[model samples]
Target: GRHQANDPRPSHFEYNGVRFGQDNLNVFAGLCAVDTPEHVEQMMKVLRDNGQVCTRMGAYKPRTNPYAFQGHGKDCLPYVFELAGKYGIKVIAMEITHESHMAEIFEALHQTGDPTGVMLQIGTRNTQNFELLKIVGRQQRFPVLLKRGFGITLDESLNAAEYLASEGNRKVVFGLRGMKTNMGDPHRNMVDFAHVPVVKRLTRMPVCIDPSHSVGTRAAGPDGMLDISHVVAQGVIAGANMVLVDFHPAPATALVDGPQALTLPELPYFLEDVAIAREAY
Candidate 1:
């Protein structure tokens, strides 16, 4: 069943002791294909300089082609925790591809002495993986970030969150990563900005926008930072409690998703725009 617009679910949830809801906004920089410890440091510096610390550091890459640059895997988990600690990042988001991977993730965290903070991410491709959802819901150690599937409807999106809630782990944050459409545009997907407010009104969970995936474009071309900034601002004004942006110190040299990633130099301006937008709401 759909969540009634008037449903009495909690509107805010705490992650690592910090609350996220109407008044607070969580801005995360997504580091795609971060393969080395040096890259981790570079990304952390960017976030720090911008007065932002937390990031969506990709430990596993869900690539379509076998030849693509998959992420640094388990070997890089320690670096993620270590570097995040050195930089004072409060929360770091990492993907969990399967139920089996959960053990490995935990083992890595445990070895690292359980870093500062962690958020388990259910990538867009695994949003509807019921088995994984059930497992994540049962384990309440970390909060879950559930991204919207490329072409999934709002009902399906909410239902996916329900899977986690049903298992008694209601600490779920909903992410809107745009939708698949036949539009002939350079962007990777058609970002459904309207859904931001809709999700906010329908559920008690916090809503986030993934502008990097929504406004996909190669960095070699004209900068799409402006476009991304616009959508992020729109999402925030529409009711999003967080905005996830993919950024690389050198986007042109990124192993994966370089086109949609914002270069280090461009991030500050975009973030400034986001700050202004945030003030309006």
Candidate 2:
């Protein structure tokens, strides 16, 4: 199409040794939030043991409920970076709600001597925060992961991502985190895996799926396959380049999104399942 003739940005981006659109399956799995140093230590240890170096740690959680746990924010940054460094983690996928959060993360990274890198996340809650998006776009130190708005159309989400690219940071990964409608009741949100290919064709950004948030459950259904396992299969088979899911040392006590968080013990089998799915593709 003539539309792509003028676009000069590459069709993909790379981070932590994993290049998207290259058929390399990179899994970003970890706690939904940093609960304590003990938990961070355990999560990093398990990830290192599994040979997984990328993770998702929500230091600034944006909850719908005002009283809900809103993450430890800057307070937990030092220890989280320390633990990530101790265990050889390369990139910690952390979310930033406000522009200042970026500075805080940078400060923490500086304090830690930059032992590990961080992939800045623009969560679903702030998907349309144009100001924040522009701020992230101006930064070149970290790559960006922008999640689809839970209630907006796909076009809106892609346009929002353009806000970042237009600001000079073309290293962006588009994430599909499902919608907030009830049409997908009995599940968290309507499974949006069908759009994996659509997103790939529409933009140069690599597409990633958050099966954890899309399915909103770790339990299995009548098929006896864990919901997350099934959801991930759909995304991987449909041409997703990366995956971002939630995992915890103990889901029963996770401060946020505990019900959908997979336990640490399930890591091995889950990894195997993803490997098989990628092979199936």
Off by over 4 Å in 1: 1-8, 218-225
Best by TM-score: 2
* Candidate 2 ranges with C-alpha deviation above 4 Å: 1-8
Backbone clash numbers for all candidates listed: 2, 0
lDDT of 1 at 137: 93
Q: Which candidate gets the maximum lDDT versus the true structure?
A: 2
In Å, residue 171's CA in model 1 sits off its true spot by: 0.7
| Alpha-carbon deviation at 75 in model 2, angstroms | 0.8
List the pairs of residues colliding in candidate 2. Answer: none
RMSD, model 2, all Cα superposed?
1.7
Tally clashes: model 2: 0
lDDT tens digits, residues 1-281, model 2? 21373467577676666566624567999988999999999999999999998889999998989999999999999999989989999988899999999999999999988878898999998999999999999988899999999899998999899899889888888999888885548788888988988887778778889999888887797988898999898899888888999999988989999999988898988899888888888
